[model samples]
Target: MTPRADPLTVDVVDLIGTVVVRFHEEYEHAAAEHSLTGAQARLLSLLAVEPLPMRRLAQRLKCEPSNVTGIVDRLESRGLVERRPDPDDRRVKLAAPTAEGARTAERLRASLDFAREPLGQLTVAERTLLKQLLQRMLGITPEPSQNPEQEEKKGGKGEKKREQGE
Candidate 1:
């Protein structure tokens, strides 16, 4: 049987999935000693900032509120997070990290005990550039072309070459 050649284009969704999987693998490896699932550890980190409404957390995690309930239950079982009544609204439930959870976050961040170490190899300039590019790709900024003139200033040569199939 003859092999089919791969098309020149790559799907954006496939690229995103690949990156997510690679990041999760690295994160799991780094946090393996903590006896905490990656999702639990991530939730603990999120709660360390301030108590957040459970619904808001679920939105942030891009999961159903019920799914977050299970994630939070596991974290709560580990004493890494606590639930409290929202002061602003009695109907709302707030989630916050415990003191032990804060300590764990500090330990994890201070020990460089996560996938972030791979990013450390990049220089500050490279990191900044990567962040900017990713932000643009994610549509986080209204102005997608930070240097729009650069392409036009190339004097139409690029378009001509493309038209001629160079």
Candidate 2:
């Protein structure tokens, strides 16, 4: 019989941590020419993809909504973002990237391709295998989690709801 790999021998968490650090380092360098902070670049990119409510954006960014307001304000001052009234609820504001903001995000992304070159060294087959293996081991592809607004929309069980009398 073939020898079994020891489950305890694998340090997958450390490997993932290293990968994230390296990726961010490369990203910081790539976007340096744009003079945008990492957070700014990330926020711009998010808004470019789709307009999101302030609360939702804050949640996605893992920060307080008030903090998101400041970010949005800065971006707006730079003419990179614009806010509009939500269709369903005028009281709610939706944030979207302007054309200039989209362009900035695209430029940042193009520059960031330098970070992918190392991955290109792997053969297509190896890359595919690695991706599949990692996915299988993790049971999910890593990505950002839902924002508080999204949780609210999902009817968060733990969230308090106002009673009619209260």
Candidate 3:
């Protein structure tokens, strides 16, 4: 049989799946080391970026708000998280990390120690594109940001075009 120019989607998906599974397993181990469940660890990681309302977090975590409440309650009991009224909307409570929680989160993030050096070679636009593509493949929405195409159009068209030409 003649070789195809592009790889089959199934093959690509299988490879991506393998990578995701491996990453998840490592994350779970790291979470366990910190005395947290994978779900709880994930919640902490999300909050580390910024405080978010329980409902919003549930939406991002793809779980019911009630589940987020329980998780938050547990974290609160451990002094890993705290609920504070949203300054803009007093009715809604945002989950913010405590100092200890932030420290734990930093430790957890540092422990991953995975192969990230290769990513250093990618240009900013290329890295953004890679991140967006992975998020798409994982069925996650890409966060709002200027895309690589937009970046190219803005000031790097010639540079990108030259790279593409090579």
Candidate 4:
């Protein structure tokens, strides 16, 4: 049988901590280049893909909706983002990036050199494995995959616990 890994050590914890800290530092630096806070840049990045409800953004950012509102308000004033009614649910508003916001987000992403270089060196499969491992480490289950090999990699539970809010 394969031997189980030992429990996490302080050194390992510190290494992960350092990685998180450095990643944020890099992100914050990129955000500052665009005159945006890291949080604003993050929300803009998400919107660049697709508009999301404030509640959803708040959940993803692990912050209060009021905080998201304030950020969105500033972005809106700058003509970077616009609040639109969700067609599926009129009661909810979706925060979408304006054309300028999309470009800004793209630029901010491109400027994150620290992440870009190392991640670029990895193959697509290696990147996917890294993502899945990170998700599990952070208690965020990786999404269920169609490939049988991937399903086997899930090992259990992760596939069933896909819903973030739940």
- For all candidates in order, the CA lDDT equals 0.71, 0.75, 0.85, 0.85
Candidate 2 overall Cα lDDT vs. reference?
Answer: 0.75
| lDDT (Cα, tens digit) per residue for candidate 1, span 60-155 | 878898988998888888888889999899888899888888888777656543346655554444445666788888878744543434433544
CA RMSD of all predictions: 10.3, 16.3, 6.5, 10.2
Error of 3 at 140 (Å): 8.8
- Candidate 2: stretches off by over 4 Å: 1-10, 125-166
lDDT string for model 4 (58-138, tens) is 999999999999999999999999999999999989999999999999999889998767765654455678787788888
For model 3 the TM-score comes to 0.72
Order of models, best lDDT first: 3, 4, 2, 1
Lowest lDDT 10-residue stretch of candidate 4: 156-165
- Quote each prediction's TM-score: 0.66, 0.69, 0.72, 0.75
True lDDT of residue 74, candidate 2: 87
Superposed on all Cα atoms, model 2 deviates from the true structure by an RMSD in Å of 16.3
Model 2 residue 165 distance off true place after TM-score fit, in angstroms: 73
User: Candidate 3: where is the Cα deviation over 4 Å?
Assistant: 1-7, 115-129, 135-166
Ranking by TM-score: 4, 3, 2, 1
Decoy 1 TM-score against native: 0.66
Model 1 stretches astray by more than 4 angstroms:
1-19, 111-115, 142-166
What tens-digit string does per-residue lDDT give for candidate 2 at 1-166? Answer: 9786566645666667888898888777765678777777778888888999988888888889888899889889999999999989999889999999999988888787644676555544444467667777879764454344454456433333322223
